[model samples]
Target: MRLRNYLLTSIILLTSLPVLAQYGSQKKADNLFNKFSFVSAAQVYHNLIEKDFNADYATRQLADSYAFMRNPDSAVVYYKKVVEQPNVPIAYYYNYAQALRGVKAYKESRVWLKRYKKAGGEINDEKFLKDSDFINSIFNAKQQYFLTDVNFNSKYSDFGAYEHDGHIYFASSRNTGVSTKHIYGWNEEPFLDIYVTDKSVNDSIIDHKSKLKGDINTIYHEGPITITKDGKTIFFSRNNFSKNVLGKDEEGMTNLKIYKASLIEDEWTNIEELPFNSNDFSNGHPALNNDGTKLYFASNMPDGFGGTDIYYVDINNDGSFGKPQNLGNVVNTDKNERFPFINNEGVLFFSSDGHPGLGLLDIFGTVSDKDNNIISVLNLGVPVNSSKDDFSFFMNEDGLSGYFASNRNGGIGSDDIYAYDRIPQLKIEGTITDITTNTPVPNAMVTLLDSNNKEIARLETDDDGNYEINIDRDTDYIINIKKDNYIEDTRQVSSKGLENKVRSITADFNLNRIVKKVTPITELYPIYFDFNKFDIRRDGTVELDRIVNLMMNTYPSMIIKIESHTDSRGSSKYNDKLSLDRANATYKYLVDKGVDPNRITEYKGYGEQKLTNDCDDTMDCTEEQHQANRRTQFIVIKME
Candidate 1:
């Protein structure tokens, strides 16, 4: 029997050709690929993928080869195919989104990224954000900003701009030197170096661009540079180096480091590398405040929040560096963050792929109030950001117009510098109040729902019953005000076609109280009659339903009185007659909907005699004010 079992195992192992190759060729391909031997690895992965189309390992590696090869068009083709397969890995959804964005398919990229976020556990095939909080996060999208590419962008990669003394300093790969022969394996663009352009005008016109006069532009990639207010001190990023020779890691690749250069007789001299830089990991994208007391940069160093978190170090008065401090989880995520820029107003702007965004890296801003204690981070929405990689944001000293970088669609090169101006604010503000008491209703929840009743934004009324919603442009919104024990109110507002016009709207809610908890003698809510109409409308039925449910379930033998009233517009005889019909109608509706008629002992019509608010013939009142007088109430007369 043991011999037979062994024979069966041997047969099974021998016949599983696909499984064997999946275990064999995939490992070889991955090993070769990790060594950056993309040419050989692609060939091996290609053969394996051809045999089994659903082989995720082979398919992923092959696509990654093209992605790392800076061939997004080819990568997207494979990724699109991979995402279509059943039981695909969730991470592949994100990868496919990135590939789509790289090819400038911005709209398509968002669909895949949303799918990636939805690719949760197997038990639930619906949206991953079935919970309330997640649903709220993606309820609204920002599409107000206007982004236009600056003309200074070269045919090569030109990005990361800094403005000083009427000259703009930025990094580019325009291939101005013989070093252009050496291309980075990733992205295949020429090694980046800083360039200064002395142009004054703001439009797309470009002129007077040249390399930095100093030795700042090196053979390897040199990244974003930051200058202090005095303009005498500068900190820039470059490849890890010792004595001008590029330093390589164990894998024979270069990492980034921060170096400080001092202005000596108009020449940037005395270059000293900051101490905390590691040979294995990277630290790049230096940004400084006006005084240069602290330096912020992005790094993949050990024990960080995740991939490439932003870190800050204190630059002491004597030029010594302090220990690096991670910016915490609020500012960092499990993915990459790069290109941090701090403006003069103490606002910290950075880029990240981990935060909720359009698709890829979207620029985010963090700011603090005067005490430097209040911190808030906001996503700088499109067109300043896109479904593509947008990073390295820098605002001018004036804090108005500035520049950022993006590999987004319609750019002239691989990464282009884009000049942007802040868009105007559009908003809606309101208050919720009780009509009878004429008092503000604090803690009232105001929800702004779309046409489908999906809440885009919600807030509670403050202590003064005030609520504000920063509405989006060209969208119709339904504002719902709800509070416990009060009738819910809804109003529809259209924001469409209000883009060019500066319009902020005011909306107010006056809710009638619905107190259904009868105290064996307490008065219930008013059943309002509309302009001499004696019929119970849908609003009146809602109150009647609540009363019916309470009396039947909570107070079975309780006796009650239904009183209906009309406004002071009609004669007393006419109003009293109309009010009686309304009271009868309310009672009939309750009896029809399974409410015990015996529980309703008597029905009365008070007309306008028992007005809740001060609105009479002598008092000047609008239709809305007069609505308070026209109401219905149910009083519990006796208990079992």
Candidate 2:
């Protein structure tokens, strides 16, 4: 549904006009305001209480235009000047509230929100309710206890504070060097280092500091620290200043590298460099998956969205690192992004100066699935962010209390840490089972969905076929259950205002046997393979395992011939050998995994001789259609 303008249609524009006796116009300021054209057509309302001051309708208009341009900070400053007028419109406060929200002044935003409501300014209540920033402010104020002053000093730039298990880990630039005084060009503050602080101390009156493990602290740049959910592994940034890795530059410092420190017994030891560190580029600000199978970090490597990008390095079977793959443009930009944190819910939190923010670098978060598909990147507005470089974020399962670093004064140093509590909006859960037999379908995938039918989570049924999904407590969600030999099932449920409780929702599906009339590959299609190679991916082998299980259940005594073929793109002789290798690879995988080799008796490679279509060998065919010729089939030669 199209949103109708809730307020008066006559949107006033701001511009400056010449008054009596002042022959010269304020050309520079007027021109500056005009250049920042707004997307929506704005009126030229004149705010003319000025002789030489750069004030007018356009100045006011420019502030509103800045909001449209997503430069909320500029808008806030201009709106502040406009609201000072004795007789300004109530709408000015309303627009100003939004600008305050953009810069992450939640309390100020709330004050304006109240003013907007008091003045009877029009707004979409539904939209306001759905605004994560507005909702989070209310949540933090009610559920969390914000930490007051952390007694440190004007000696560091601390931020990106987060909580793991029970401890708080943050980034700071506290004197750890013979002459530890480095400055960030952007904020002109001291360069950062990682720090840990505790939450058990009195926060409102005074802030206590946490100690670092020995001299684990480095003199070079360090930030974006994270601890595993189990509280065993600690990951943090280290500027790669290794003498061998980066040949001593004029500054004699290497690039940056993310290091992992593990806790063995009660002591943290065995500090080692992460897998993807190199001498060429800087790689830091790592975010680890819950299972520790994937590591996400930011880098300025080639083929990135812009400057620094978030990259994923998959963990190999032997715990070694794989090639780092860029997370693509979804989570990255040409702008500098730092301090990435991943919650147990798979939501990602980071700080960026590129995306429009209320200040220099504000904290932002995006809800993502296990596959890293981003649903939205929302600003953590108000109390959490401000008109300064507010970053180094952390959160708990409850989404209430967490810590972050900032330079908003009232701290021990150039930057200090703060903590706040918040309320978790809502969540969902359910189970999937067999309808006819009332038995659990182990390993079945149960997905929770939103209004757009986007899958939020793909939970697997436990050994007994019981599945539980945790989501925000008050949102609506759809459930989809998919299992082999069972009909696909879908259901929708709303958890609006539902308290934190395990909702018992039973989604039972009937098992449907494989009927010949149905599409055979409905269970299998679009098979995967390596680049220019016929070997199946590990996941493809898993898929084939299901096929093997199905064949064994349906025809226990059946003798089948496994045939593999390849597209006619290459020479027939080469195609023949490739096809045979693929068939042998599949056979070996099945055999090694305990599938009876005798039941998969014959293995044949047709060598592009068998075409599902009528295309001739030399005919020009699309690669997709050619793929049809390169296929795998199991023919039941004999069944008992």
Task: Give the candidate number with the greatest TM-score.
Answer: 1
lDDT accuracy of residue 342 in candidate 2: 66
- Model 1 regions lying over 4 Å from their true place: 1-144, 176-180, 201-209, 367-376, 424-640
- Clash number for each model: 2, 43
**Alpha-carbon lDDT of model 2:** 0.59
Candidate 2, residue 602: the lDDT equals 72
Listed in order, each prediction's TM-score against the native is 0.45, 0.42
Worst 10 residues of 2 by lDDT: 1-10
Q: Assess each prediction's global lDDT (C-alpha) against the native.
A: 0.70, 0.59
Tens digit per residue, CA lDDT, model 1, 1-640: 0000000000000011122344356545544443334556678878876786325445666776666544568888887777775444455676676677676787887787788767651223234222222211221122334555576787788888999888898988777545336577788877888877766765443422376666666778886899888888888999886576888889997899998888888777777889998889999999996678999999999898779999899989997989998888868889998888877655678999998777799988763432553144456766777899999998766444689988888878898998875433345777788764458999898877766676555567878888765554445668898999788988887655543334355678887667454455455676666776887878887878878877788777666778888888778899889888888888888899988766676788888888777777778888888877777787765544
Which sections of candidate 2 miss by over 4 Å? 1-155, 176-194, 201-211, 243-253, 264-267, 369-372, 409-411, 424-640
Count steric clashes of candidate 1.
2
Candidate 2 lDDT tens digits, 268-375: 567788767766777887888767778888888767778787777887778788999876565677887777766655566788888656688888776343244664
